[model samples]
Target: MNVTIVGGGVAGTLTANYLATRLRDEVRRKEIEITLISDRDKLLYEPGLLYLIFNRLEEKDILRDLKILLDPGVKFVFKRADKIDLENREIRLGDEKLSYDYLVIATGSRIVPEEIPGLTKTGHWFYNLDGAVRLRDEIAKFKGGKIVVSVMGVPHKCPVAPIEVTFLLHDFLKIHGIRKSSEIIYTYPINRVFLMESVSELVQNLFTEKGIETRTFFNPIEVDAEKREVLTLEGERERFDLLISIPPHKGSKVIIDSGISDDGWVPTDRYTLKVKGHDNAFAIGDTTDLPVSKAGSVAHFQAEVVAENISAEIKGLPPTARYFGKAMCFIETSFNEATYIWFDYETQPKFVKPNKFTHWMKIAYNRMFWLTARGVL
Candidate 1:
């Protein structure tokens, strides 16, 4: 049987590794073959990019060769997955085809900043590596002014990121002796700062303690580059010297174009992780429209469930494994202090208090990610 996975990102790579390790004999004996397809040769550790702006990590340190994920029985194809002919059980690479007995769509999500008028032209962000580097330069040059860190849309990956960025900026500016002169504002469409009630309360207190202003229900409609202001749907205007935006995001082009996704994200059974209406197919990570935060930890949890289900099927057993819709995220408060949150569909996020050791755990995660890809940790 040929089990093909699309994408080499966190979702795809981890799923491949878990399955390979789980079905060692099946893969080794050629009873099942695992093939992973990637559009890029390198995997960017996105969570580490935030630290890049503060000089905690270098560019090379945040990226890893995708080739390192491949073991003896696993194969990788470096090509753009243009489409999937689900009816024919084949994936189309331009005009070529790769047949598959089981498929995992882990193409992930993408940011579409240009969707908002002048967003790309006026605002800056640290969501990507290049953006982090560019923003670092701009931030270092900023002596004093209003800095706005905002969420342009809902359901973005890691809802706490903008909050994290603001806290880090406060510390960074204080270190440079510009904290008093600078105004830090955080805005989002929702009234709360985070999904978890307790976590939201914690973040609200943190915002107040750090002297960062919070603005809610500011549903952004457009960004005015020349005017240095954001116009909201409610006719309110917020101005800033530098705008750090969490732009609009959607699923990948292939997932959208393949017609598997409704509005760029495919729907899946929350517990089973199976793509709705497709018994032999599943979608994981940011590519699936699940009622959970789209973070790497969520992807990691989803991958384990998907791999387990596939392994069960190969062994002529039913899929007993289930996903609980729970995920954990570490919020970087400053250079050496951090906190974490854990939430699921049933429970409110009740996190541990912020401390130094939790911060180090986050730092260690940057390296542990590689071990996971290499199938050792």
Candidate 2:
């Protein structure tokens, strides 16, 4: 059976690995083949992008080539996935197409800063590898400006990234001896500072303690680079000397183009990670509109569920595993300290106090993630 996974990101990669161990048992190894399709050759370690902005980590340190990451049981097609033909159960490329007995959509999402006026010219984003590199360089040259870290919309990748950026900027500026002149400001679309009320209140208190200014309910309508101002749809103007903006994010173009997305995100069952209206198709990770934070931890959690379901499907059994929207991530408060938060749909996020051990744990997790990609962790 040809099991095709359309994405080389965390979700697709993990699912493929899980299938390799399950379906590629010594006797059935010859019967099942896992094919992964993606445009990129390397998987960028997204969580480390924050460290990139501080010029502490190199691009190569965080990226793993698909060739090195994939198992021998998986065949990787290093090309763009152009289309998904639902009627024929095939995925299309420019000159070739692959028919799948089972398909998984984990193509992930893309940032569209250009969707907002003048945003590309006025701000630096740290979501993608290229953007992180650019932001790192830009942050270095900044000379005591009103650095505004703002979010364009919700359901963005790593929901806490903008907040983390704001925290890092405080330390970055202080280290450069410019904290006195540089004002760190943060803005979000909603009145609440974060998705959870308790976490939001705690974060707000921390921001207040640090003297970081906050502006809520400011969705970007336009960016004026020359005047260093951001105009909101509510006709509110927020001035900034340096803008580090998180632009509007949407699901991958291929997913949207294939008519499988509800406004750029594939709608999925919150508990099962199963795509709606499809019998053999499932989705995981940032590609799905799962109402969970679009972070790698969430993606990994979904992959575990999808992998179990795929194994059951291959064996003609019913799905026995389900996802519970579990997510936990280490919040890097400073160079020396980090905080870890763990939560699920039923549990409120519980965080460990920021300390050196948590920082080391996050670093250790980053290393383990690469091993996990190879099915060794």
Candidate 3:
């Protein structure tokens, strides 16, 4: 049996490692083959990008070669998947096709700054390596002005990142002796600062304490780069000397091109982690249409379920694993303090007060994330 996995992000990498370990005997006997396809050669520690913008972590600390991270039992292919032909159970890469007995789609999400008018030119973001490096330079040169941190759309990866960056920016400005002159305006599309009521309440109180300004029900329709203004759907024009935006996000284009989903997100069974209507195929991480946070932790949790179920089926056992929408995120409240929240589908999110201990724990995880990706933690 040939098990093929697409993408090389957290979900793909962890699932591959878990399956390799679980099916080691099959792999050694050449009864089963595992392959992972990725366009990039390096595995980026995505969560560290937030710290990268603040110059807290360098590029070297967050990137690892894919060869070192993958298990010896799994084969790695460095190529861009052009299309996923679900009908034929094959993935098309340029001129070649790779067939699979079972497939896992973990293609992940991408930021579409071009989706918003003038956003690519007028705004800065920290969602990717290039954006983070550019934003790091922008933040370093900032002397203090009105900075707008706006959430342009929902269902974006790392739902708490905008808030985290706002908190971190406040401390960054203060440390630079410019907090008094700078104004931090945070905007979200909904009436609340966050989707979760509990998290919103906690974040609102924190924002008030820190003197950060917030604008709710704010959705940007266009950015006037020449005028340095954000035109919103609500008919309000918000001016900013520096614009920091969380642009819109979408799932892999290969999935969309394959007619799997209109928006690139694969229709997936929330519990079984299977691609809807296909028992032999599964979807995880940011590529799935599940309502969980598109954070790496969610991908990590889902990988366990996918790996187990696939391994059981290959072993001719009953595949009974299910995912319960478990997700966790660490919210950095300041340069030295942070808090975290964890929840499953049935539970409401609850967070403790930010403290130095939790802050260090987050820092430790940032460095230890490689182990998690390798399924070692």
Candidate 4:
């Protein structure tokens, strides 16, 4: 039987790798053809982009070739998926169609800059590789001003990123001898800084101690680029010299138009990663409607469960593997220190003390990204 996985991202790559190395061996005892489809031939290691901004990592080092990432038993198809036909068990890639017995949708999220008026034309975003590079260049030239960093909406990949950016900006400005002159503001609609109360309190205290202003429940309604002003839904206005905006995100049109997603995200069994309303379909990574944080660590755990279920189905056995919604995130506070948070659906996040070791773990993750991208992890 052929298993076709769409989107050569963390979810797709890890799921296919685990299925081939462990699950297929215990069940099928024979090679089950695995095909991975995506628009690009490389897997981007995104977590390291923060280090890349400070010339700590090279751009070439942040990518791994997809051709080498898959196992010998897996076929790599570098093409943009047009649609997923669940009824016909086919995936359309432009003019071509690939038949599949099982399918995995990990196409990830899309940034809609147009959703926030003037954001696309005036403000800046740094979610992807290209945007990160542009923002790096723009930041290098900025000496000092009101640097506003914010999230545009919910369900954004790596929710802690905007806060990390704010902290990093603090360090960046200090290095440029403009820390006192620059005003950093972080605004978000969430009542708390993070999902957990303890973590939120810690982050809030850090922001307060650092002299960075924090604004909660301030949903940005409009941006006046000419005047460097931000108008919020609460009838409040804030001015900034440089606006760093995280535009609204949505599921890929391919997933939505294919009827696999609701409200721009694939609805799935939270524990199984199986797409709801479809038996032979599953989703992982940033594309799924999982209750946990959308981070690479969560995707890795979800992929394991998904692979087991797929393998169990092939063996005519009940799928016993289940996801526990585990996710861990390393919040970069400064170049010297970072904090870790571990959480699951049943428990609130508990903060781990920051030390030199935490900083080293962040550094080691850079290497893990390379190995995972190559499907070895």
> Mind giving the per-residue lDDT tens digits that candidate 3 earns over 107-222?
99999999989999889999999999999999999999999999999989999999999999999999999999999999999999999999999999999999999999999999
Tens-digit per-residue lDDT, 24-104, candidate 2: 782154777789999998998898898888987788879989888888788889999998876689899988988998888
Candidate 4: where is the Cα deviation over 4 Å? Answer: 23-31
What digit string (tens of lDDT, one per residue) describes model 4 on residues 122-218?
A: 7887778777777778888898889888776887888888888888889889988999999999988878776667888988888898899988888
TM-score of each: 0.97, 0.97, 0.99, 0.95
* Residue lDDT tens for model 1, 1-377: 98999988888989998989888999878899999999988988888878888787889888988887666667889999999877788999987999999999999888888888988898998888778899888887999999999899977866778888989999999999999999998988877876566877888998999899988888888999999999898788999999999988888899778888666788899999888988899999998899898898898889999999999999999889999988988998887799988878887777778899999998898878788776666
Count of steric clashes across candidates, in order: 0, 0, 0, 0
Please name the candidate that would achieve the greatest lDDT relative to the true structure: 3
In terms of TM-score, the best-performing candidate is 3
Please say which candidate is ahead in lDDT: 3 or 4: 3
lDDT for model 1: 0.87
List the pairs of residues colliding in candidate 3.
none
lDDT per model, in order? Answer: 0.87, 0.85, 0.95, 0.82
Error of 3 at 157 (Å): 0.6
